[model samples]
Target chain A: MKVGILGAGQLGRMLAIAGYPLEMSFSFYDTSGSPSVGFGDILVDKGGSGAKLEEFLNKVDVVTYEFEHLPLELTQKIEKLKPLYPSSKSIEVCQNRAKEKALFTELGIPTAEYRVATSAEELAEAAAELGCPVVAKSVTEGYDGKGQAVLRDVADAEQAWSSINHDAVIVESFINFSRELSIIAARSTTGEVAFYPLAENNHHDGILRYSIAPAPKVSTELQQQAESHIKALINDLDHVGILTLELFETPEGLIANEMAPRVHNSGHWSIEGAASSQFENHLRAIAGLPLGNTAANKPTCMINIIAEKGDKEAILKLPYAHLHLYGKEERTGRKLGHVTVQADSYEELVWRVKNVATFLPGSPEFISSIS
Target chain B: MKVGILGAGQLGRMLAIAGYPLEMSFSFYDTSGSPSVGFGDILVDKGGSGAKLEEFLNKVDVVTYEFEHLPLELTQKIEKLKPLYPSSKSIEVCQNRAKEKALFTELGIPTAEYRVATSAEELAEAAAELGCPVVAKSVTEGYDGKGQAVLRDVADAEQAWSSINHDAVIVESFINFSRELSIIAARSTTGEVAFYPLAENNHHDGILRYSIAPAPKVSTELQQQAESHIKALINDLDHVGILTLELFETPEGLIANEMAPRVHNSGHWSIEGAASSQFENHLRAIAGLPLGNTAANKPTCMINIIAEKGDKEAILKLPYAHLHLYGKEERTGRKLGHVTVQADSYEELVWRVKNVATFLPGSPEFISSIS
Candidate 1:
């Protein structure tokens, strides 16, 4: 089978790696020359020539995307030529904050209190209604910490509106959650559904830094609630591939945050920790193959290597550490690679992960609070 | 780093698969159009042209071979341009049965009684001296069940000699053994050495059928003796990368049979059963990276898929089974791929492997004697 992918980034590269053993070939199309050039056979730089996109699509059996920000119009056109997993409508809903939250509300899924606004006065009204310390975000094309700001008081509403720079915006009530949790769910074309264990994530400057599988210390009841909501959302969207649902653990219950319609960074630990990896499962689901077992082999933790090129020898020498370098040039705050550590027990896993983290360039503090 | 390989069969393809994540690039040289052409960046067809050989060698940083049958003169020429792991001398010894057995005897390693013969009369004489029912093998370019024959009596000597066809042959006394076993070991450029657990192998028509890891029900003292012999051979050769030693279990102890100076088929279970795969460890040794842990992750068994392709869906549905397809056109009795089954217990591993083996094309009887 030949698979075509949009936005050939690291996710696409990992997907291609997983597909090779299954006898699947890959071609990629990206606006810029993507780093996937190393693994992919045909790279269509869409920025250089518009006609190459059609030529590339003709050679593949199915189409998919790595990044959620892919334009909906292009996705719909590609669907006409070949099957596109997760559907363009799902991406359309996820690319905009308002639409995503609205879908959650309509499905009776719990989410933070919010209101839509278009101007400075409207932002102030929404902020006043939600109380002080509210978050104002653009409806579309927003990621990381960009195109969003926290409004502490009425005096800060004007600057918050201008910082967004977009007329249409979503103002949401500030969430005070105990921890951040995520669930990765996969729905096959034949309607087979599977969910990976819940993951506890920690972020540094709005970028994911560390994730622990099975979300240590969480009750079984809480995981069941999160799985219920995710099942409802994927069924309603008629999703065909992997979908990641981010949640907030509050006093009441699990609250919905946003979702990504592709393989996620928080799930990288599965490559070494689980019986089967998320990248392989996602490819299996989209290709109409049987889904693999999602059982964990051991307690696992993953830490991202951002920007700094740490000593490779130091990381490779540590026991139970699996180092994955992206073969990318180092840039400040760029995710160059990650390391996954697995242990027979959770205590040992934490200790090994912390010891490995200290060898990193910035000496990240992902496990400081575990003690 | 870039590495060049002499043969582009499944072994070379697997080596390239393991090298990609380590930021290594590969080019292959083969007499015929290699199957690795789909995955490799360069394919030098040695049969069609001679000029491309130098051009191909110039692009690689170092050189290695997937098979030990590479021509000694060609290997010497390549050594002048780049460093070759295992050295040309080691390959020379492994390529010829007489030199290999002589080295074993010179090093005081226990092997079956053997005598070199130059003609049919010499073969008859060697058989008479060694006793009846002796086996004869060709000097070089022999593999699987080819280039070998057995002499059961004095009258059978001419037919056995004619069956071999080659004038240079090594005739040996056929000894009765309890079982067949093999071990894979690696030595780094800096003298770092690691040994994988012993594997119990079964062969049909001289081709490897199935392998069980850790050689179940064996005494630790016996394994230590085998390891000692392997260590002495590798140290004397100053070997780099991986070497596999095949042994026969007898009433006295373990006796040497043969050895491959590259990764062996019996070690395929290491891809999932061990903490690190043999292919990855070989690449690390050649690339000057640190050798990883060689401990087994669980009790494991691997079965080779030959000739016909099996039902991929049925194989993928089996729990804890990892399917690896070579993406090559199937030919009768040709190795197409392999499936490895891992489990927490030996009983469970055997049960699962047997269930999966039934789904294969040949329905091999390798696991029937486990009880």
Candidate 2:
């Protein structure tokens, strides 16, 4: 089977890897050439959207994107020739905060108290209602904690409002959640849901620092709540492909934070640890095939080796961590690479993740390896 | 860094997995798509031999190959573009029986007593040099124990010689060896040598069935012999990339059976069991990067999942055997996948490999309980 991917990136590279067992042929198209699409047949063209798209569609059996920001009009145009999963309409909702939150509410899912802030005055009013220590985010084009701000008091509201150059923003109460968890579920075109283990994620300066599979400390009730919301959303959207729903484990209950409409970086460890990788599962879903097993052989912890002004060799010394380095030439606060470590015990995983970075120049090793 | 591969097959796919670190990019170009090139970026065209090769010349920084049959013309054409590791000269030797044996003799590598036979008269003369029960093989294109026949007596010799359709055949004395073993070693683009642990292999009907890493019967004497021959070969050919030498262990000594000039299937267990996989090491050699550690984490036994006459689900029942299914859609004597199981003890490793076959059906389980 021939499968075509738009935006040839690491995600597409992994999808091709997953397709290896099924003998699925993959070809990729990207504008500037994705750094991570080092594997498979790739074609890079700098033409504008919809240019030569008909020709591209003719060569492939199916079309999918590695990213949500793919030109919807171009994809819609190609839809005439081949199938594009997660429909262009779905990307519209997931790309904007207002649409995503509204859809969540309509689907009867739990979320934080949020209000639309089209102006600075509305932002202040929403902040007053949501309380101090609130989060104000741009309605669109925000990721990796970018285009978001924290309003500690009334003082930061105006600054936060203007800081977002976009037309609209969202203001919500900063829930004092115990921890953060994420669910990565794949919904096939046929409405099949294959959920990987709930992942516990830790962040450093708004960057995903670590993720542990079979998220430790998650209650069965909380897991059920998350799964239910994911299923409802999949059914509501008639979605196809993987959905990464970030959630907050609050004292009140679980609350939705944000959702990525495609493969999430938080679930990268599944490549070696899981029975079938997220990339493979996503391809299976998009290709309309039965999902493979999502079981893990052992506990796996993935630590993002953020290259923050240092050499990579220091942390790569850890023998157990499966190091993945992105072929990014410059490393200035870049996601240069990640490390996945599978161990018999959680304690060993913690030891490896915490201390491995200490070998690097600037990354201060955690004092006691506590969350 | 950028590295180029002449042929894209499973070996190239495995290398891409290993190239996760070092932030390296490997580009593979096969005449046609190969299953191994499924996960990595593949370049294809009939344009490589002419000025169309100009687009690829400066693009790839270094060059290596996934197999010995890298077209001699393409290898020579790309020589001016960048360094081609192991050199095009080695292929001329490894691709032919007379040249391979002569090269082995030149390097003082212990190989079986053999003579080249291009005709019936020559076959009779070579039989005198290597006594009866000799193996007659076509000088080229013989693989996986195919295109070869056993000569038991004088009557069998005439039938076998004419049957080998190739222009010439090499007659090798069949040694009464107890077992087969293989060694995979790496030589950097500059000729630095590193040897992975020796692997003990078992074949069924002349096809590799299973391989156990850190070969159970390892002794100081055998280790020294294996390492010296590999080092000698590397220095003689000024070889680069990986060299996988297959051998037979007999009462007399270790005898070289055949050599694969790239990553071999017998070393697949290294992906999970060794500190660094053979695939990664191959890319490292081609990229001129520092090689990774190749020490075995634990003993691992791997079983080749062949599509025998019956039973498909039997392999899924084996515990701890990491199953890898090559996505090939075919039946009847096709190699579709493999399973590798790691354990603290050889008894456990052996039990897993032997009993894992039972999980697929048409076989009875013989694996013992932990107790």
Candidate 3:
């Protein structure tokens, strides 16, 4: 089968790599002229024009986007021509915080309390009403902590609103959570769903730096709670591929932070940790193949290589470290690659993850359920 | 690193897949006009001329071949310009049975008693001396049960010799063996070696149909014996990549049958069974990186999908079965792909293997140490 990806980034590259063994070929549509996915037939449609998009659509049997923030018109057009997994409605919802929050509310999934604001005065009022230290984020096109600011007090709302610079923003009460976690689940075209165990995540500078799968010390109840919420979202949207819901473990229960309408970084550990990788399962779901096992094979940790790869040889020396470079050049805060470390026990996995982290410059200290 | 593969077959395709995650790019030189490896910078060097060969060599930082039957002159020529792992000497030794047996003898490796014959008269005499029921194989360019014939009586020697139709042949007494096994080992440029567990293989019509890794009931002594033999060969050749030694487990001990200087079919199980796969380790070795852990993650069995894939959906539905298609058209007796099934216990693995085999048309009954 031929698959066309809307964004030719690392996620698309990994999806192609995973799908190749299934005898699936890929053609990547790079909206950004500089495509980092070094292989595959890449069409650079910088202008998102007529001929190139038509050519890409003609080449593929199905369509999926790695990035959710793509132009809605393009995805809708592609959907008209070919089957688009997760659908354009998924994109429309995930790209806007207000719509996403409304979906969570409609599905009875718990999320952070929030109010939409269209002006600085309204933002200040919402922050005052929600209580101080709220996070004000743009209603749309926000990711990786961009288009966001913190309101320590109601007085800081003006600066926060100006920093966000969007006509509308959502002011959410920041929940003081014990930890951050994410659940990745895949839904097939036949509507069969499989959920990977919750992964504990650690972010530095608003970028995911570490993720440990089967999140150490997670109880059956907690995992089920996370799974049920994501399942509701997936079923509600009639999602056809992977859908990720980021959550915060608070005193009350798991509260949804956000959802990504595609394969996520926190699920990257599945490449080595679980029986089947998220990338592979995502492809399998869209291709109408049966979903693979989602159980964790071992205690595994994925350490992101951001900005620079300090020492390739040192990391390679760690026998358990499975280094995956995206074939992207070095740049500040750019995710060049990731290394997955697995062990018989979480104790050993932590030590090995720490060993690998030492070779990645600017890597945050290893953090997870056990550490 | 840029890796140029000598053949664009399934092995080279898998090598490219494994190496891409390590930030390595691939270019494949297909001496045959038809290249099955679906992806990569494929250069069809059917003419074996100077310019195409030079272009291929120039594009790669290192070189390796998936198949050993390539023209030695071409390999040696490429070796002069690029660092070809396992070297031309490895190819020289592997392509000729006489030289391979001689090397085995020099290393004190046990094998079936054999003699070289130049003509039908010599072959008949050798068969008589060895007692009848001997197998005669061409001294060079033989693989997958090709260029061989068996003699049940002394009078059949001329027919067997004529059937082989080679200038020189090796006549050996056919020994009754308990099972066929193979050990895969990788040696790094730094001379560090790591060995994967021995795989118990079952062959049908001279093609490998199934392989069970860490070969069930293998005593520590037996594993060490197999490892030692492979290590000796790797060291003798100063090999810098994967070296596979196929063995016949007899009443006495293991007897060396043959060797391949690149990744072998039996090691395909490592892709999902071992902590590190043979293909990945092979690339790591050739790229001058440290070898990965070669320990089996679980009791695993690999069932080759010969000729035709019966039911892809059925295989995919088997959660533990990792299906790998080579993207080749179905042909009688051709290896199209394989499915790796893993279970926590040997008994469970055997059952799973049998379950997976049922969906593969014409698959031989599953056989292994446990079964």
Error of 1 at B227 (Å): 1.9
In the range A1-371, model 2's lDDT, one tens digit per residue, is 68888877667766776676555778888776444566566677666545655566777888887788666577677777788887777788888889999988998888888998988888888888888889988988888888898988876778898887668899888788888899989988777788888898888677887788978777788778999999888778778988889999888888898888888888898876776778877887887766666776668877665665244544444557566765554464566566677778777777766666564443345323544
- lDDT by residue (tens digit), candidate 3, B102-131: 999999999999999999999999999999
Off by over 4 Å in 3: A366-370, B47-51, B366-370
Q: Which is the better candidate, 2 or 3, if ranked by TM-score?
A: 3
DockQ of each: 0.67, 0.30, 0.80
lDDT of 3 by residue, A51-135 (tens): 5888898999999989999888978888898999979999999999999999999988899899999999999999999999899
Q: What is candidate 2's lDDT per residue for B197-309, written digit by digit as tens?
A: 89988776667777889888789789779888877776677778888888889887888888877888899988777867888777767666556677787888766766642
| Residue A347 lDDT in candidate 3 | 85
Give the range of the ten consecutive residues with the poorest summed lDDT in model 1 chain A. A362-371
Q: Tell me which of candidates 2 and 3 scores higher on DockQ.
A: 3
Which residue pairs clash in candidate 1?
none
Candidate 1 Cα lDDT to native: 0.85
lDDT of 3 at B342: 90
Choose 1 or 3, whichever is better by lDDT: 3
